[model samples]
Target: MTQSAARPAGRRGQRLTYLVKRLEMAERARMEEVLRPLGVTLHQYTALSILEAREGLSSAQLARRHVVTPQAMHQLIATMERDRLIERRPDEGNRRILRAWLTEHGVQVLKECHRAVDDVEERMLSRLAPEEAVAFGSALERCLESLTVPPEGLARHGDRTA
Candidate 1:
């Protein structure tokens, strides 16, 4: 019996992993600096922002959009409810379904989050020209298309060849 090389391109895969970890750390540090004073984690801030935009969304829908589990979102909603940040009410036409909406407090917090987010974006991209920023973002979104994955970590579309 023989074992194939664990990774045919072992050094390249190691480089990829290191790059991902570095990026994740950098993003988390930036978000923490912006959000820590607001008393909301990045995920929580994101939830509030989404509710502010959509007003009312089911937990499932929120989870799908936020890339969180339904259970995780339920817990987050419970915390937000206790804080009076959001209110959940049964859908009028679908009594079985509950929609989450921003309370006045939620709106206020979202406004703060937006300001913080804007500050961060402006600082991060201030050196870029407007057209260059647009081009950079468009290119990033194209890169993101391949990053989307199913719950099981399988690519939803495109070849996984690497």
Candidate 2:
């Protein structure tokens, strides 16, 4: 059993996984509230941010980066394309491969969202010193590294039963 499962039910909240899950839910809720007025969901905002940093990503690549399925990314890309928030063009060498990029309007919207997100982040980290904030982020990264495993390895170990 997991460490958290070993704990008494009433004290489960004190476990790392429970606390992390709670924090993720609360943060997502707050982000949704703040981004709703801007007419963009957190996932869309994240896609825009990713496109900003790495232009010309395929829908499949974006899905992997976003930790979502390719079908979901395709739907999201279609909606964003319809709204003119993103533009998709065939790759130069491979006509079958479509690359996505943010439009001017999308960039402007992202700038506005950045300000609002900054406010939320500032408020969330207000209690922490700068060093503490950095350390906390590093710790989270370490936890993520520990949990992540190669799919091939999972198959080799027959751990995919669930």
lDDT of 1 at 155: 45
The CA lDDT at 102 in model 1 is 91
Model 1 lDDT per residue over 1-162, tens place = 245453233345655446657756877788879988987778888888888778789999999899999999989988888988899999999999899999888888878978987888777678899999999787566556656654354444543443
Candidate 2 off by > 4 Å? 1-13, 149-162
List CA RMSD, all candidates. 6.1, 5.8
Clashes of each: 0, 0
Q: Candidate 1, which ten residues in sequence have the lowest lDDT sum?
A: 1-10
lDDT of 1 at 54: 89
Per-model TM-score versus the true fold: 0.73, 0.81
The pairs that clash in candidate 2 are: none
Q: Candidate 1, TM-score vs. the true structure?
A: 0.73
- Model 1 residue 61 lDDT score: 95
